[model samples]
Target: MPPVPQQHGHGMESPSIFQKSEMGAMMGGGVGLTIGFIFGSWSIIRHGAGPRGFMATLSQYMLSSAATFSFFLAIGSVIRSDSPLALRMEAMQLQLSASNPILRSKAESAQIVRARWAEERSRASN
Candidate 1:
């Protein structure tokens, strides 16, 4: 094949690693907040609040919020732990593990997988 003309002379596009990780962490934090709100509001309402109950509710809310924040914080740390290089390595690992033959074979045994793969393959060949 003829070599494609280069825009930046073969240099690849470089996205900021920190920004990408922040986005994932923010998404995880949103997920955690959603979980907390869905579960925590009901918990407070169900329990009701007197003076001690008020304190208890505040405590629970703080605990739940903290839990949510920490969960996302951990996700960010994992994603950006070693900069752009580590992130690429982790992505490669995920792709390899997810496509392993043993796992794929097990999935193929299930009727759902058979139907899905057949559909996908047929679609692709078109």
Candidate 2:
């Protein structure tokens, strides 16, 4: 009988909570800045804010929206990092072991290799 391979650590480690939160904040801020810029520019253009007023209002909207976005994004990141979704998925994968398409494909390939090995052994014996 062939020795079974030992299983190692889980496939890939998820990012740390801090890293996730930071990434979320950056992405949210970028999105918010884009949205704020578009709306702010449109408003300033439509309402004919003078140069100074336009600048002030635009800056205020941009900063406030970005800050709000970052806060929500950080909160979402924290929730995701601490969620049980990943654990549930892993458990489901384990439970469905042989039924998993990826695992099934690998198993089929291994069977082909084993059959070839057996054929080689038989030929050598004969």
Candidate 3:
């Protein structure tokens, strides 16, 4: 009878630190803009006790709305690729794992190589 191979321990490789920072910044900016919009609009709506104040408030509201829309539009344009950040992260992790010495054993290395080849073939096919 053949002896069973010992199982190796390998944690998944992590995402690129840069991509994570970018994603965090993107999300943070989005949330900050949302909060700003809400508070700015509230302040405009609640304190317009005279015609001049109301006109000024209305003008500010329109400008704010336009600016917010443009900012998000720019972000949408920048991230227009269908490949999401999570997918990019997964590919990076796979690449790092495939290259790392600690994760590369004879058996595991062979398996990783075959898997990578298969992935490439499929990608080429598509």
Candidate 4:
């Protein structure tokens, strides 16, 4: 029996909470910015900017909306909750365990290469 590549024991790890939070914040900020721009433009057309000036008022709206959304979203996964890295590792395991000799060999070799590269990178970083 061949040895199975265990995803859990392997050096591969799911995205950290911080990474997830950052992703959510980025997504929310972008969406909020777009929405803010649209609403600000409409507001300017309908009511006109006060003495604060059009650019100033528009920017205030954009920044406020972006900050509000990013803060809330960063607290939790507002858009993406799953780690893509986990998904990739799962897919790789399927290939590595495939009954087809060629596919298994390729997957095994790829896994070995990646592990070696990661080791080297860690060494270099230190």
lDDT per model vs. reference: 0.64, 0.79, 0.60, 0.80
Model 2 RMSD vs true structure: 11.0
lDDT of 3 by residue, 1-103 (tens): 4667433246434434445445555665566557655765677767653566655665565556556655665466446433346687976787678565254
Model 1 Cα lDDT, one tens digit per residue, 12-96: 6444566556656666666666666656677767876656765566566656775677566757666654455777887677767
Deviating ranges (above 4 Å) for candidate 1? 1-14, 50-63, 66-70, 73-126
* Tens-place lDDT digits, model 4, residues 11-65: 7765676877987889779978987899998999899998999999999888888
RMSD of candidates 1 onward, in order: 12.6, 11.0, 14.8, 10.9
In model 3, how large is the Cα lDDT of residue 73?
A: 53
Estimated TM-score for each candidate: 0.39, 0.53, 0.30, 0.52
For model 2, give the 10-residue run with minimal summed lDDT. Answer: 5-14
The lDDT of model 1 is: 0.64
> Candidate 2 or 3, higher lDDT?
2
Clashes of 3: 0
Give the lDDT of residue 109 in candidate 2: 83
Q: Give per-residue CA lDDT, model 2, range 1-20, as digits (tens).
A: 57675333575545667877
Which residue segments of model 3 deviate by more than 4 Å?
1-12, 49-126
Model 3 lDDT-worst window of ten:
6-15
Worst 10 residues of 4 by lDDT: 1-10
